[model samples]
Target: MDQFTNFTRKVSANLTPFAEKVGTNFSQLRQIATEKMSNSAIITELPREYVETENRFEPVKHIHADLVRLARKYALDEGNVDFNKLQNQFIEITSSIGEKITNLASQNPQQQNTQNQTQNAYKPLNVTIQHQLASACISNSEIVGASLYKFGSTYEKIGDFRVKMNHDILENCINLLQGEFTSNIELAQKSRKDVQGARLALDALKSSLKGASSSKQAATAIEIEKAEEVFIIAVQDSMKHMKFVLGSPIIIESLRNFAAAQLEYFKESQSLLETLVTELEEIKLTQDALYYSEVDHH
Candidate 1:
């Protein structure tokens, strides 16, 4: 009985910090998103903030810049939607995870990590066509040749071609984020339900420990120890969920997608530009040959 008491207290201690951290993580993320949502959209348009308009229309680190411009403007400002119907996505996802943490604190531990099959897991609800391209898989890959550098030739087109390539990449990234936003929000809802089920099982052990007798208490403690082991397995999952609450995975994926999109443009532009230079070289050779033949005849 004494052993059970000590073990129960230990489990309680572990759960307290986990529960509190879960709350803090969710609140921190939701707060950051709320604070930045409106201003970020405006900042994305400003020169050199999220995008550079002069030399190259390149995006800066602010990946969610377009969401600031398009979603907030159309959905919140002009669309006339209510808060309940259209809550901010980050806030919504955090809220969903927060509820899961609350339920899990009382419930049984899970046998498997849900993070293995979370929203972006499995087949990927948001498929990135760019990631399929070679450039996306291989970052910063480019082709160079001596013919590309000839005076007033293919080298001149490089600057404009790169800019256009980046433009397409940024555009695709923006669209991808927009699409995944809703899907993740929905996943949060579903994850909450799955966690709730785990919570239900977890509650049984807690109840067993609540008013256990000398005989039953030992069994109860053992059951708790079993549940604790599960919690231990799922702790890594919790941390992943915490990061998901903070919107890191989506942002990281977007950056990768940008690189992938750029790769495609690099390949296609090199092909077309190299072909043009080759044709130009052939035409120059023909002209020289004709001139030399006329000179010989004279």
Candidate 2:
């Protein structure tokens, strides 16, 4: 995140001057378009600032000088001019700007963005097409604001179509991020449920084993057998619930690995019980000592 912040800062710094120059050019064009003159479109034949014109057509001169200034400023800022790439594009845009402004003076308010275009009035398909394109462009993973504007037409009412486009893209990005967040949350809930079930099963199993180990002098063998049977049934019930909770492939694999290790410990405990019973069955102390010695050696 810190790295991303640093990268954005550097980008913003580099774009600042470029943004300023573009703004200046935009203002100059707006001023020229809005100017009112007696016999011509320009108010002052010669710009008060620039004074290099001789006997050339004055408005044409301003337009020429403005274009040169724009080209020079752009070149200085960029450090290189790619005429092969940008010259034709420049001519096309300048011509479009001239036509748009000319139409605006004739009461056809410049239809800057698609949304603000009035000629397509009463056309529902146009509206639908505009909205769908906007949605897809904004939601697209590959495009950002500038790319959308460079490749697509935008509206004046849509206002800095780049900004609106970015906002829409951001909304889609939020929805995508939220989906990941929700998936993680669900996984965490499942993990917690599995852990709780396993814990309860383990506790019940421990308690039952403790009860079996704590049996002392009791009634008949059948009664003792019934007591152990009851404990085993209770333990089996707990294990069934644990298995249900761990039925998922991921959980089952983990349980299989864990149970493999734990089953040995229970077997060792059973072996210890068998050894004690074997010692108890011996009638003589010598016999008990011999059996104990053999079991310890084994």
Candidate 3:
């Protein structure tokens, strides 16, 4: 873990300062640093964790759902917006996000308890799918960024390296995505077991809480309380397995780099779009001036 952390620190030390010099905002880069750099397993496990575990889940789910709804609202609020393009992009991005959420929610204790053996058997597959999803998200960001770069740069030879870099990043993401898809099938088989185990633990805790509240039986309450505590600890341990597999700092660092690169691409893209809009406005003004001038001369 220390070695991984050092590697991440070193990678950041090298890339971030240079990226800032090249014009990347250091602060608006949280998504890159936390989400991208964290192990793919952590990213995969987080959405699941926040969704599955009742004690730690409700607030997180509410926040996530709200974010999703807000994003949809923004897309729809534009009355003049191109509905097809806007909605399609929104759906693709959001749906992928939703899938991640689903995976998290599926980790109920009831499901996990029923499939313990199967879950243990399919660890490898789960790992693969998770890596794929994490890699794809990064790669997709690069692809979008590269397209923007190409459009923004007007295909100039000087921007060739940037374009090529984008392609390389895209390729890397694609490979990871493919691996994830392959692993996803195996992971599914164990999903039930994972969720069931978690649910059972939560159920036990709930029953204990009720016993403490209803009966004046201190001993029974203590026993239930201890059971609940034990259950929570067990759940935490299980989640760690899923989380650490991907939460490795090395993966996190790589994701950070990918995110940083994409942000650059996005900024460049926005600039290009603005330039195009400005040029069109100028052309319209020039045409209007020519028409008025000719009429006056006549």
Candidate 4:
């Protein structure tokens, strides 16, 4: 028992620095994911409607819905104005805002183009669909990354339990390495979910566009299809965040480096642990005479 205790202490002293270095490497992986993988340019690649106002022909824009309430509040704060004159001026200002609200409400437009332009303000979201998809991709990527982090945290807890069970630094290190490997697998699972989440939102947005009666909305239907392509591409690109990324030659090399580190750590630690175990077993067998003498003396 004494042999095991002292051996574990020695192993802990050796492994603590390695654990710190692994932690630093993990931080670097996250930074790389944030810095190298995040692509905001995709947002700008979307349709103009996302970045600017749609070219709809509704005559009024940014109408103050509380204009009347504001005017009434102003009147209450001030000394009494002539009621008749205030009423005339209020009507004129409201009339200037919209023909429908004014005395000209009964008059129809003479031109067909003018008549056609005065339709309902039901603007569909076709123009900005691409940008919305891009935003969704970004949001889901963050969600998947967050999920992966949580998986790692959970695995770390399991590692703690394993270390407690064994009371060996070698066990602790091996458990932690196993936990990381499991969490890496979970990252891929969560990424698939991220893709599904983005797809569901995009489908819902497309459904909402179906109610619009504008000619532009028809054009937008076509535009949304293009946006869907971008969404898929963006999602594919987001997988670069994985520490154990797999794909092209450059990515595979990166994955290999991380894998190699983990494997090397495990190999070296296991080798050291086996050596200690063998030494302890030999001491336990050969030191029996001394051990019994000390026990008898005590």
Best by lDDT: 1
Deviation of model 3 at 258, angstroms: 5.9
Q: Estimate each model's TM-score.
A: 0.27, 0.22, 0.26, 0.23
Q: What are the runs in model 3 whose C-alpha is more than 4 Å off?
A: 1-240, 249-258
- Candidate order by lDDT, decreasing, is 1, 3, 4, 2
The lDDT per prediction is: 0.45, 0.39, 0.43, 0.41
Candidate 1 lDDT, 72-106, residue by residue in tens? 34323233333233323223433454554465466
For model 2, the stretches where C-alpha displacement exceeds 4 angstroms are 1-120, 123-172, 179-181, 210-298
The local lDDT score (0 to 100) that residue 274 gets in candidate 3 is: 76
Clashing pairs in 4: none
For every model in order, what is the number of clashing pairs? 8, 3, 25, 0
Candidate number achieving the greatest TM-score relative to the actual structure: 1
Writing each residue's lDDT as its tens digit, candidate 2 over 123-241 gives 22212233345434533414443344322333221212222222222233223333443344345345434433333333333333433643532433444365345535544443443
Tell me the tens digit of each residue's lDDT in model 3 across 165-274: 34333333323333443244234324434544444433433433453645545765665566456555555655554443333343334345456655665676567557
What's the CA error at residue 12 for candidate 2, in Å? 69
Residue pairs in clash, model 1: 41-68, 107-199, 107-202, 107-203, 108-201, 108-202, 108-203, 136-260
Clashing pairs in 2: 113-154, 113-155, 113-156
Candidate 3 at residue 66, lDDT? 51
List residue ranges in candidate 4 displaced over 4 A.
Answer: 1-174, 178-183, 216-219, 238-298
